[model samples]
Target: MTEQEYFTVHHQLTINAEPLPEGSSLPSYPIFESEIPAPFIVASEFSHLDMLNDSARKELNNSDFKHVINLLDTQNSKLNLLLTFLLSQQDDPTYRTITSAFGASQCTFLSPTSLNDGQYVRIKLFLEHPAAAIYCYASVVECQAQEQGFDITVKYQLLRDADQDLLIKAALNQQQKLLRQRSLDRENNQ
Candidate 1:
């Protein structure tokens, strides 16, 4: 490896992954089992959802236990409708389990479709926290044809500081989970 490449640190993780939907078109059905599906939320839409979620949380923040259920019940339909509307706009989304090596600057994952060098991509993943989602833009660095389509590597282009921190935390957690799994396997074999 080149000196620069050798100096880069990466953490590997296996998760479901998916390509983003194209042209603002939503598939008729929901995307299931996606490892990471891009959320094509407009700024206004994001603001709306954020406000709604915040309001929802505030409603029950310190309410009496009896009122918590009532608050959720009152908002459930609106929240469901909003979520349903958002999901309807994504294109043919497919989720497949793939292993990836990711760092703050870049990520590598297997793709069922061939991607050209320098192609733009958006990578999204969620950590243990439901509210924590990683949404970053990237450019394809390499796309080598392997088994089905290509083994693609992408460099981050539009990663925010908050998103980068999220990635770092998720990567570390994934590494520890892998290590624990390996140790367990070794013990079982012995």
Candidate 2:
């Protein structure tokens, strides 16, 4: 698919926080709903329902939970960064399947949740597929609510060379289209 079809310049805003840390029971955060304008990088055009497991789906459906946010950053050749967000406490899983030209080594989760730095979360992904099933762990780093959804910034912690190569390929193919869409969005917003 063309990058334009996969990405938009618009932001989604919401408020809900759930904390799931390693070796600890899940904790619930108070649900706060609001809208905020934030920038995002769309990683794929695929739907969330396609890649998630049954448990993930149920967790994502909660009222405090919001939609997932995806972002892609292709800066390094060895690793491409894919960032995703679970906007609310509602339990609706986000899932996607990617075909990789290069294979991945490992995946890691970063920070869990934070109220500062504009609702940020970070996850490091490892790839293991030519057509592989990859599981990612994400920790919240910062969060805030606005007019659209929740504004967030996330860091990718663990990535391998194969993961990087696949991201580079996807980005190279989509860069032009993504740029065009960004331009269009700018004009519309003004």
Candidate 3:
């Protein structure tokens, strides 16, 4: 197994991990995928938001338009919140499993059943903060039995480049949030 090159965050997020049925074939990679999945559509919208932010930064290089950039930033935040609310309403609790830890390369979650090592599974990860989702394929790397159930870790096999970047950014953002909270706690204790 390749060493994890990216930082991981232990966070709770909705995910659906379904094992591939016997004799079933994996879906084509997103680039050649015929039917655009809902998660892919959502990811595309998030990418558009990222592109807009990048453009705004480039165009608003002068301090004179700092307020304009701030306004755009506020609008983006509102949009993300709205998207997140809408996505949550559509999420099916039956398929929801909270991820114990995740990074760009892989995610681990608790499951009721034992999944065989090297088993292929389809994954749909719903990210709340970024208001995005990822539809991809992964292979089960490890499954360890726990008191309640099994902790299954799957490595991404067919994730899009953009979706991977989103995961990386989300992990970094989560790390920053944790650091900030720790600093505040230390300051209060001192």
Candidate 4:
């Protein structure tokens, strides 16, 4: 299949490889999706978000209401952490940020560790904005050694429909955030 079949975006990933045969053909395994939602928002956090929104709405009659709402929105925005992540080094110890390219069908990224082509591995992804985490198994399609590390391409296997949807949604959200950043940067530069 063509690479363009699904949209791609740059992101950071936490990866773990399951051992396989010394040398093998394309490996296959089931994907393990994280039960936790992204942006680390849990059921308990909904009240916090709702409270912020409620506070902002109650002040609609104030003279500076618009600006006040904007301020609250900035702090409570779902994408706030993601924007910060996109601009700075994230503190998560699980996975390091690499120049990652991901789509619905496959993902390619760079890493310090070398994984053989056809090797199966567990991948953990923290997607931007609503910051959902997805865990899945993939087979290495290609692994080229670079001066710095390994540039690896992988095709996903045994992913559930929901997990596939999550990947696609994350890619779309990330692309939107990247575009937003680019536009804002352009505006400031102008």
lDDT of 3 by residue, 114-188 (tens): 988888887878876566877778888999999989999999887777778778878887889999999999999
Among all windows of ten consecutive residues in candidate 3, which has the lowest summed lDDT? 30-39
**Which 10 consecutive positions of candidate 4 have the poorest summed lDDT?**
35-44
Query: Model 2: per-residue lDDT, tens digit, 1-190?
Result: 1111122122111212223343442122211101111111112212122234335646665644544311111222122222232211121234111111111221112223233432222222222111111222223344556454443433222322333344443344345556788899999999
lDDT score of model 4?
0.59
Off by over 4 Å in 3: 1-4, 22-24, 30-32, 51-70
Residues 1-190, candidate 1: write the lDDT tens digits: 0112211234444333444434332222223113234452332244345546666676666686547656665775565455545544432346443445776567777888877676666555433311244555567788888876678887765555545555555566666777898999999999
- Candidate 1 residue pairs in clash (backbone atoms < 3 Å): 16-35, 26-89, 26-90, 27-90
Model 4 TM: 0.56
Q: Name the candidate, 1 or 2, with the larger TM-score value.
A: 1
Backbone clash tally (model 3) = 0
> Candidate 1 has what TM-score?
0.50
RMSD of each: 10.1, 18.6, 3.1, 7.3
The residue-by-residue lDDT of candidate 4 on 1-190, one tens digit each, is 2233676677765443343455644333321334323333331243335446675577674655787777766776755555435423323444454546887788887867787777875555555434444455678888988898888888876455555666776677778888999999999999
Candidate order, TM-score descending: 3, 4, 1, 2
Worst 10 residues of 2 by lDDT: 32-41
